[model samples]
Target: MSAPTYIYKLVSFSSPVPDPLPEKLPLSELDVASGFIHMSTPLQVPRTLKRFFAEDPRIYILRVKYSTVEKNIKWEDSKGEVPGEVGAEGMFAHIYNRGLGTTEIESVAIWERNRDWDEPLKKAESWLVY
Candidate 1:
């Protein structure tokens, strides 16, 4: 028998907004929960590959990055913090759908494998996402 193979998948989500916004819109509490469900996976790889190749596969590392602007409010006047009134206005508009806010999602997956299985499987799993 040959050494096992490894596979990895990553997925990310962001708020709906455009560039130039100080920050991406905050995800609703519900949206955060939904995002996890959006990242489900089903086992479909052939048994020859999954059972023999993936069993005891090497450990892999994955990382995901997401960015969005957050509304900040403070009593004291500060350049960094958004004014309370403006924050309130934007929040109200966001809730009412006056416009959509924006966020950016990025993800990466990394793993080390025996040279024999590295090239082909890496290419195949490169674009895999949940």
Candidate 2:
């Protein structure tokens, strides 16, 4: 299959993403430590959240155009503790040498941690560029 047109960045609700969004987004602790930004494909967002951000009360799923960050992105093997979890093709997108910027973002959708989780998952699916 062809690469997705877009990728998703999950931001903690604690970090306020401005209404107009900013040129550069603050890196998550994991991102800072890892030296690259973690991102997921459209179909990978829900599982990513469940695995990594399950404790977060809310999350901001930033829809970003793949073209904008294509040069900086590396399709690397699963680097997390658990191998292959939430990884598509056993690889995930990792952005290096720069932070995620506003120019790439198409939209931002808020997903709260709901009891069933399905509602938020559906909302996230709807926000994806497909």
Candidate 3:
């Protein structure tokens, strides 16, 4: 399959992955509890961070392609995606598979709260990969 342009994963220091990165990273406890791996687009990161990652000291953003997850990824409408609505359109991308690895990740950068957190990733393609 052709790789997706990009998808985003939010991570903290404790977020699971092995040193030097891994070919396959394990899902977090939160992922198992929710039954899907939650990922955001550039359009969704601001709200995602506010709702799920508020006030966190460090947030790492990882860019990945859909080909890495296409076998088990699903695009579904979110129930509360638009508020006061029962079902929304293609509002979220979820991983139906098991885990993701560093090889699947294209680029990664540290998002410090002091920097452009105001815009909070205006565009998924805007970050400088390190």
Candidate 4:
């Protein structure tokens, strides 16, 4: 049987680079803007991502949100975790299992299946590209 597929949503913010800035400027000091929401599946997960979660032994449900400042991006999480701090770009909820190792994550639903949010996640890749 084929293994189940898993999908994750990632969001980021971006803005044009600004003019010269003072030394020791923090990210908060720059302009930021909402980028976009992207959907990713296990098949598409990068090697870096796999290495990052190698020892975690838990699957995750990630939700991401962002806003723009002058030209920098500010991130937040609906799950109460600090946004943009987890390395990857998004908010996440960890789903764990006691003895089954890790819970299998199937496909994720953002807009096509569910429309809970105003913005829906775009597919990781377009079929036309293939």
Scored by TM-score, the top model is 2
Model 4, CA-based lDDT = 0.27
Best by lDDT: 2
Model 2 weakest lDDT span, ten residues long = 78-87
- Model 2, residue 87: what's the lDDT? 33
Query: Which sections of candidate 1 miss by over 4 Å?
Result: 1-15, 20-24, 32-63, 66-104, 107-130
In TM-score terms, candidate 3 sits at 0.72
Please identify which of the two predictions, 2 or 4, would achieve the higher lDDT against the true structure: 2
- lDDT ranking from best candidate downward: 2, 3, 1, 4
* Per-candidate total of colliding backbone pairs: 7, 0, 0, 11
Q: Which candidate would rank higher by lDDT, 1 or 3?
A: 3
Candidate 4 residue runs with Cα over 4 Å from true position: 1-6, 10-34, 46-49, 61-130
Model 2: residues with Cα > 4 Å off, grouped in runs: 80-88
* Candidate 4 structure quality by residue, lDDT tens digits, 1-130: 1211233432122221122322222221111222222223333343323443333323333321211111122233433345543224443322211101112212222222133221121343431010
Full-model lDDT, candidate 2: 0.77
How do the residues 45-122 of candidate 1 rate in per-residue lDDT, one tens digit apiece? 222234334533333222112112112112111222333332222211012121122222332333334544345355
Clashing pairs in 1: 5-53, 16-101, 17-101, 17-102, 23-69, 24-68, 24-69
For residues 5-97, could you state the per-residue lDDT of candidate 2 as single tens digits?
Answer: 889898887886788888887888889898888888877776788887888888888888888888887777647333342235767888889
The lDDT for every candidate, in the order shown, is 0.27, 0.77, 0.63, 0.27
- State the weakest 10-residue window (summed lDDT) of model 4: 96-105
> Who is ahead in lDDT, 1 or 2?
2
